[model samples]
Target: MEVSRSMKDIQWLRHRVGQFLCVGFDGLTVPSHVNDLLTTHHVGNIILFSRNVSTTEQLIQLNQELQTIAKQGGQELPLTISADQENGVVRRLPADIPGLPGNMALGATGNAQWALKSGQLTAQLLRHVGINFNLAPVLDVNNNAKNPVIGVRSFADTPDMVADFGEKFIQGLQSQGVIACGKHFPGHGDTTVDSHLQLPTINHGRPRLERVELVPFRRAIEAGVDALMTAHVVFPAIEPKPIAATLSRRVLTDLLRQELGFNGLIITDCLEMNAVANTVGVGRGAVMALQAGADMVLVSHRLDRQLDALASIVQAVETGELSQDRIDDAYQRVANLKKARLTSNRRVRPWAQLIEETRTLQHDLAEHAVTKLRWESPLPPSVRRVAVLVDERVPVMVAAGDNHSPVLLADALQAVRPDLHSTVFRFPETLQQVRTDDLLAQLRQYDFVLIGINGGENKDYLEFVHQVHAQSILNVTLLLRSPYDAHLVPQSTNLLALYENTPWMAEAAVAAMFGGTADGALPVRIP
Candidate 1:
C-alpha cells in the first residue's frame, strides 16, 4: 500500500509536504524569497507568468537556474515548471511568442487537425523554454454568452466537439513529452462571474453536468491527460452545501476521483484567488484541498502565503487532522508524474526556428478562425482617404492576469492603406466632448471608416459609430473581443468577429476585410 519506501527511511516528511506547494514570484529571475523556498522550505514546483519572462533566452536561463536551485536544496527530482500558456487570450509568454487563434477560433474552423497542430506547436514552444507542464486546451464548453472569463478560451459550445478537439490536443502535447492539463474542471463556462474576483455557483443538476461539463474531462482522461486543474466555482448539485469545487470532498474525491474514473494528478487553482481566499483563508484552504483529494496545492503570488500553506499542510499531517495516507497518496502521484514526464535530455530548439514554426502555424490557424459576420460591398475604387479608429484601453480581465501590451489593429490596417488616418479613443473618461466632435468632423471627410469594438460596452464609442454610419460612409465594424456583440450593435453590416484582441488575430481580420478570405463559421450562438 505504501509508495516507494516507508517514512522511517526519510529524514523528515516536512520536505515531502513542500512538493505539494507551487508558488509564483514577481521578477525575471529567482528572487531571494523564492530561492529560500526552494533551498530551505524545499518547494519543488514553480508557476511562471509574463512578469517572470522577457525573452526566450532569458526565460530559458531562469528555468535552468530554478532547476539548479532545487537540486542544490537537496531535492531529488527535477522541478515541474508550469505556465498558463493557453496561446489565445490567456497567453503568458511575450508578444513574440506565437499567439495562436486560441480555442474558439479553432472550433470555428471545425477541423480537429488544427487543434492537434496547435497543441504540438504550444508544447514545442513551452518545452523549448524549459516548461514541462502546460495549463491549457480549456475543456470548458462556453455555452454561456455572458461568460466573462472563458469566451474564446473554450473550443466549442457542444460537449462532443470540445471532447474531439481536446482529445486531439492532448495527443499532440503528450507526443512532444510536455504534460497537458485540461482545466477548470466540472466547468467554469456557465457562470458570468470571474472566479479571480469572487466565487460563482453552477446549478445544473447531475444529468446536465454529465452531459456537458464532464464530457471533455472524460475524453481527456481517456486520452491520457497528465493532470486536471480544479475550478473554484461552487456546484451545489454535487455537494450538499455551497462549496467551491476546489475544496469540496464530494466534488474532488467522490465525483472527480470515483465517479469520473480520473487517476491523473488533481491540482487546485491558485489559493490566492478570491474564490478560495475570501471564503476559507489561503493557508486553511490549502490544507483542506489536500485532505479533500488534490495532489498539488497552488498558492501562486505571495511568498508568505506559499510558506504558510506548506506549514499548514505539515501541521495538519503532524496533528492527525489530515491523515498520513492521504499525504502519501498525493505525494506518490506527484512523484510518479515527475518521473514519467521530466527529463534531463530536454533540448531547447533554436529560438528563431521555433518562432518561425509557431508563427507559421498561427498564421494558418488565424486565417481559418477569422469569421466575416457580414460583408455587403467593397470600398469604392476612387476612395482617396480612409479613417481607422480603435479603443486605447484593451479590456484585460483580472482573470487574464495580463501584462498590458499594445494592440496592432491600427498597425495591421495601416500596412494595407498607407494613407489611412487612425484614432485611439481613451476609455472610462470617454473621448472629451471637443475631441469627439473633432473626430466625427474628421470622419466626414474620409471615404471609408474602420471601427474596433471591444465587448460592446462603450456607449460613447457606439454613438460615434452610429454617427459615422449616418453620414453614409463606407465603414466596417470589427468585433475585436466578443462574438456575441455581433447582434448587440445597431449597425450590423460588414461586421467582422475576431473573438480575441491578440496581434495575430488582428492581422488576420484586417486581411479578410480587404479582399482576403475568412471562411470560418461561428462556433457559438449569438442568442
Candidate 2:
C-alpha cells in the first residue's frame, strides 16, 4: 500500500509522526462519521465504554466493522481497541458475561494465583470480544477508605499487597496477548472525591508518594505493564503547577517517563473527566496531554473536542511549538503497541470453561475473605428463624429503575438453609413504624439475626450493627457492599466483608455461613 501525502495526507503525516487518533462509535453500530473519521484521519485507536456496549456479539461486530473501516481507509495497521473492564462497578460488558471478581475480592484472597487467574480470565473474555487492551487490574493501592471513586476498585490498602497482585495480574494478562494497563498513574486511591465530577488534590510529599502512593505503579512498570494511565489528581507538593497529572509535563514527563523509566505507552484517563474538562477545553487538554508525554489521549466522551485537539496538535507541530521528535516518540509508542497486538497470538477460550474456572476461584477467594468479625455466643448449628435487615442509604443497583436493597442476600441465605425462615425489613420504615416490642418479639423467635448493611459510610452501618449487637441476638452482620462498614462491627464476632452484592459473592457468603473455610483477614485495616 503506497501512502500518499496530500494536504490531508500531509496533515496525517505530521500527526502520525507522534500523535494518536481517537474515534467514537455510536453504540454497537459503526456510524458514517466514524468511518469517515478513520478513513480521513487514520485514527490510531478506539475505546469502548458501557454506553458503546450492549452484548458480546454486538461488541465483536463493532470491532470487526472498525477494522474493515480502517483497512478501507488505506491504513493497513491493526487498531488497538481498549475498554475499562475493571470488573465490579467499572465493568463495560454485561454482568452475565464471564466477568472476574472485583479487585477487592481478589485482594482479600491474599493469593497471587487468584489475581493471575482473574487477569487471564478477564483477558480471555476481552479477547473473544475483540478487545486488545484492558484498562484494568487497577494498580492503585486504595489506602483511604473514604475515597469515593476507587474504594473497592483497588486491590488493597497496602502498596506491597497491591504491587504483588498487580505484578501477577500484568503477567497473566500479557501472557494471553492482552495489553494490561495499570491505571490512574501516580495514584487516585487517596482522594476523597470522584475526579469525574471534580479535580482532586493529593497533598502528600514526594517521599511519602514514593513510599506509599507510587509503590504499586512502580512495581507495575517494573513488571512490564503495556501502558500507564495518568490520574486527574494534583499533587501540590510535587509540582507547583497545580494541574492534573494528565496535563502536567512535570508529572507525566519528569516523574513517570523520566524518573520511573517507563518506556511504555503513557495514556491519559478519560479527557471528559471533570479534572481535565473543567480546567481546560477538551481539545486543549488533548494537546497538553500529548505535550506532557501522553502517547495516547483518551477523549472517550467528547468527539468534537478530540477533533479540535488533533487539529491543534498538528498545527503545533507545524508552528514548531511541539517538536517533530516528540511527536514521533508518541506516535512510535502507539504504533509499537499496535504492532505488539498484531504479533500477539490471542485465541478465544471457551466461555463455559472460562466461567467455570473463574467461578471456582471467586468462590474460594470469597470463602477465605469472609471475616468472622463479631459473635456474642457460639453460632447455632441450626436456626429456626432469621430476620434480615437491609441498609437503604446507598444505591445498590446501577441503573435508574433497579431496586437498591439486598434482596438477593436474603434469597441466597434461604436457598442454603431451607429450614430457616427469613423476613426482610427496610430501614426508617422498619425503624420508625415497626414497634421495638414487635421487632424484639420477632428476634426472640429466630435463633439468629443477620444484618446486611446495603451501602454507606462506616458510622451509619456501625450504629445499626451496634444496636443489633446490643439486643443480645445471635448477631451476624454481612456487609454486602463496601468494606467501609466493617469498621462499625469492632466488638462483633461474626462479620463478613463480601465486598459487593454480586451473585458469586452472595453464594460464597452462604457457603461460608455454613462453615466452608476459615474467615480471612481484612486486607484493608478497618478504621
User: TM-score of model 1 relative to the true fold?
Assistant: 0.94
Q: Candidate 2: TM-score?
A: 0.90
TM-score of each: 0.94, 0.90
RMSD to the true structure for each prediction, in A, is: 3.2, 3.4
Report the number of the highest-lDDT candidate.
Answer: 1
- After TM-score superposition, the amount by which residue 388's alpha carbon in candidate 1 deviates from its true location, in angstroms, is 1.5
What are the lDDT figures for the candidates, one per model? Answer: 0.83, 0.77
Clashes of each: 0, 10
Mind giving the per-residue lDDT tens digits that candidate 2 earns over 1-527?
Answer: 24543566676664383237554555668877677667777786888877788877788898898888888877767788888887755678655675556788878778878788778877887888888888887888888888878888888999999999889888888888888999888999999878888899999998899999999999998889998898999988777888998888889999988899999999888787778888997778888888888888877755687677778778777888778888889888988887886555655677788778777766676677665555446566866777787766665332111424457778877667777778887665576777766766777677787777765543444465576677767877787767886665666667777776766677677777776774665678878
Candidate 1 lDDT trough over 10 residues, lowest sum? 2-11
| Stretches of model 2 off by over 4 angstroms after superposition | 1-6, 9-19, 23-26, 376-378, 395-405, 418-420, 428-440, 457-466, 489-491
